[model samples]
Target: MSKYIQAIGIWFLIIPLAIINGGLRENILIKLGDIALLLSGIILSICIFVVAYLLIPKIKNCKQTDYFIFGIIWFILTNLFDLFMYISEGGGIKDLLGSYNFLTGNLWILVVITTFISPIVVSKIKKRKGEIKNV
Candidate 1:
């Protein structure tokens, strides 16, 4: 299969995992409040990045550009999914967007930034490991 197709497949696979993460985050917030939510975000970010790093190499024939494009698509899809969930749960668009506010709501910025960067970081890490092995 082509890299683009593989990327799309990976994006689809990630959606459910993202939803699960969101659910876990919500539960944690309900139980422990914002501090736990923030900590969970950091932990979840690390776990997701590690998973991406491990999984990216399995996509045969994917180039660095493909990884980056996948990251962008994943980022966009995740935010849209979040918005959908928020609205489905009876939230207004304002509430959906307000969670992105760094000052008050949870640290969604971390997740946003991590989503944008994870694929690129994974690609570079894999490339570096290949170089080290070749040397």
Candidate 2:
């Protein structure tokens, strides 16, 4: 139970990272044109993985399944947050759904997928390093 809570707390930390990433895309990466979206998505995914690698090991005694579940939870929460943001900004359902179209160069889906895998990937890395035990 505590581990789950800690996971959620760590996810909250990611919200700020996302905000900062978006800010960069808007202010700095905007000069890159359409490629900026792809770049920002990649940057955010790497940031997410780095965060998971640094924090997931601290949740002692986590099993492989636990890490997978954490990823699933974070993925779903991220999607929900995206939905809320879109709707709040007056975007229709179609707009939100359309953003997933890779043809448009919107790599948002990739970022979500990355979020869904980071925990599990980090767990494997930590286990290999013998940094995490009680698995």
Task: Give the number of the best model, judged by lDDT.
Answer: 2
* Native-structure RMSD, model 2: 1.2
lDDT to native, each model: 0.71, 0.90
lDDT by residue for model 2 (5-90), tens = 99989998999999999999999998999999999999999999999988988898777899999999999899888988989999
By how many angstroms RMSD does model 1 differ from the true structure? Answer: 3.2
Q: Could you tell me which residue pairs clash in candidate 2?
A: none
Number of clashing pairs per prediction, in order: 0, 0
Off by over 4 Å in 2: none
Give lDDT: candidate 1, residue 103. Answer: 77
TM-score of candidate 1 against the unseen true structure: 0.80
Error of 2 at 41 (Å): 0.3
